[model samples]
Target: MKLKDSAIRPTAIAVQSPASTSTGTTAGTADRAADRTRSGVLLAALGVASFSLTFPATAWALEGLGPWSLVSCRMALGGLIAGICLLALRVRAPARRHWPALCAVAGGTCVGFPLLTTLALQTSTTSHAAVVVGLLPLTTAAYSSVRNRTRHSRTFWGAAVVGAAVVIAFAVQQSGGSPTGSDLYLFAALLVCAAGYAEGGQLAREMPGWQVIGWALVLCLPVAAVGAALALPAEPVHLTGHTIAGLLWLSAGSQFVGMWVWYRGMGAIGVARASQLQLAQPLLTLVWSVLLLGEHLTPAAPVAAVAVLVCIGVTQRARG
Candidate 1:
């Protein structure tokens, strides 16, 4: 009778096994999700660190290269590198439907932000450039929210307003209590970069992250090369080590390599959440300015950076 009972219970044991297996699978999926999110965050932070040096490096590079020459050459270099990467990796072109987004990416990042920011750095101190670039998180968050078709609470908007105000005040302080043309250029760069980031992040969801930027750079290659040719200075550049190093990094690091990580992170983590990580950029940029470019920072600059960071954090956490 005991043996017969054990044989009958085997059916129940089989039935329970499926439930246990299902539970294990669900837990495994959750763990994978958590791990992906963590990796995305770390990548975003790395990209931000790479980007923080851009303004300082540009300012340093500008000492030898004319603003137009610097922009044209760096972009051409970036385009060439990106084109080579695309060919090397055998990446397919984005479908025709994605061409519009790719064009927007090319216009905004490959053209607008780099051109505007380089010009802005010409007239602005690296410290001032850092302060202006601090506006990026707010702009990026706004654009990301729109691109993703999400809603933010009033708390988020309020925080953004306050953060913008703080940055504006800091810019004014840097310019003797009035906005300079450099401020306008930097602000334009911020808006254009936000658009590029949001568009590229969306595109990254469908394609490889690096490929999005790589393709866009390739798309702009001819234009960038022609522009560089047109903008060549009459006098040959007396290239210093700093100038050469800065241009190389700007071309390869900021424009291409950094965006690889950034778009990947944004696609994985969602653009709004990823953009929040940029709050740390201002502080990092300040450090770069002081160390790399020998720029002086006003006491207010640090205070404003902290205030903006806190404001961005609040906006990120605000409930809709």
Candidate 2:
């Protein structure tokens, strides 16, 4: 009986200990937040990995189809994919207030970026193009700041600038120290795509991430369909295995799946942090260029990759 009473007393004491209870609760909350951040980082990383394949795939696609045809068809196919999902789920139209942003997303992501990048690839090597597009994260972060009134720590901006400088130097060196015509297209792509990404990230916070992209796809379906119809008849088709595979990936993996997870990650973490993850994308794309396109890896690629990774770590540690 004494032993039982002692055990009960200890239990009562433990249950009444405010400090212990508070500590446990705080630890649990911190653990959950850390887990959520890790998950968000993982999702953003996956999207970047998916995107890294895009340039090589686009190069492969160009082998058998004209630029206009390839872009239009991929857009059309991506729209169809999202449309089917929306229909199956019976998702209603987005609120009227969201339409403008939806239109921006549709125009920038589905059409403008794809068309410009495809055009650029006609003149640029996959590696060189990857480096130029590496500026996308910086652009996206800036756009998010202005549009959403988000703030970041100086460490974050410093790291982001360092990463951007590395990529910019790589881009200039790869371009023989002058902006080529293709570089202009890529830069233009950055502006529109940054807008799309910032807006999509905002929309993701209000709705399901996949649904944000899905609705944008649906909104652009008519334009994509018409463009595809016109372009297919104009462009010659060779139907190589590479072209077919590339088109499928661009349409399904990048246009839909990548953006789906990307927006979700942005919603989880933030536009700024998630965008920083893309600093690794050019490095990944460089690898893909060698493996898939049989392109030579530049001497600067390894050095740039390492520098960018350090910057990524710093940005990740920075508080908003």
Candidate 3:
């Protein structure tokens, strides 16, 4: 997806006071920082794993449902689950003024990205799709830099260019083997998904990340429900045990727990840093696809993967 650079409209990070420093030895401060970093990495890894499963699950569900039906069902189920959890926790409703932003974020991130990606993966290999998605963080960083008009060193732009090249090369290699209309659609979906993610991260700072997502789902449910009802007639295949299991996993792991963890990490670490963790998502998805789906490994896969890793490292260093 082509990343859009929306103007930065002041996130919570901008107004946050600096962390308080207690009188401690230099080594103690270092140790504490290290601990926090490790914890963040652990949480981020969990979030990545949860997200990685989504593609395969969607693939499985596609066997039984149309893309819109699958998406609407997932959203409906996920929103219900999240609502129940939030209500149990007594989460307060956001002020009315926040509704528009919440709706925008929800539409872009929750509805548009997943719906399009599900449609794309209908004919695309999870491996190819995952590689294409590896550029998300760089796209997001580019969006942030552009929005803030933040000056970035030439090296940062160079790394982003290189990362994009690697992804394109990977795509070309996959395309040569078997390029289908669905594959092209999936590629387009990747761009859209990246844009939605970048926008969602930016908006998340203004509203509580979880609340932004949670409420967006709330506002979106009625519309999604209506869409699902209309699309139900086109859902030809009957749901199987495997499909049911996939739906369960998608709802519990990817939508509910994964989103919660991601929002928590974003709240603690700020969007840019939290987004860096997403660099691991595509790689992790590739691993899951191979192990679970019995997909053959392509020779170019590892090379492209390493290139993406290098790019992510460079991007992170640049941000620092």
Q: Assess every candidate by TM-score.
A: 0.89, 0.93, 0.80
Between prediction 1 and prediction 3, the one with superior lDDT is: 1
Per-residue lDDT, model 2, residue 79, is 89
lDDT over C-alpha atoms for residue 30 of model 1: 100
- Model 1 scores a C-alpha lDDT of 0.82
Per-residue lDDT tens digits for candidate 1, residues 109-167, read: 88899899888876778777776777787788888877778987888778877877787
Against the reference, the lDDT scores of all candidates come to 0.82, 0.92, 0.69
Best by TM-score: 2
Better of 1 and 3 by TM-score: 1
lDDT of 3 by residue, 1-320 (tens): 65545544545554433442343456688888767656655665577778888888877787777888888888888788868767988998887877665665577667776777787787788777776666665666666566656676777677777877776677667768555676666556555555555555555556655665677677778877898888888777579876787777776778767766665555444455556666667767878888878787777777877777787677656644
Error of 3 at 253 (Å): 1.9
lDDT of 2: 0.92
lDDT of 2 by residue, 1-320 (tens): 34665565644333458988899999999999898899889988988999999999999999999999999889889989999999999998899999998888888888899999999999999999999999999999999999878788999999999999999999898888988889889999999999999999888889988998899988878887888899989989999999999999999999899999998898888889999999999999999999999998878888998999999999999999
**Candidate 2: where are CA atoms >4 Å away?**
1-24
Rank order by TM-score, top first? 2, 1, 3
Total clashes in model 1, counting residue pairs 3 or more apart in sequence or in different chains: 0
Candidate 3 local lDDT, residue 278: 69
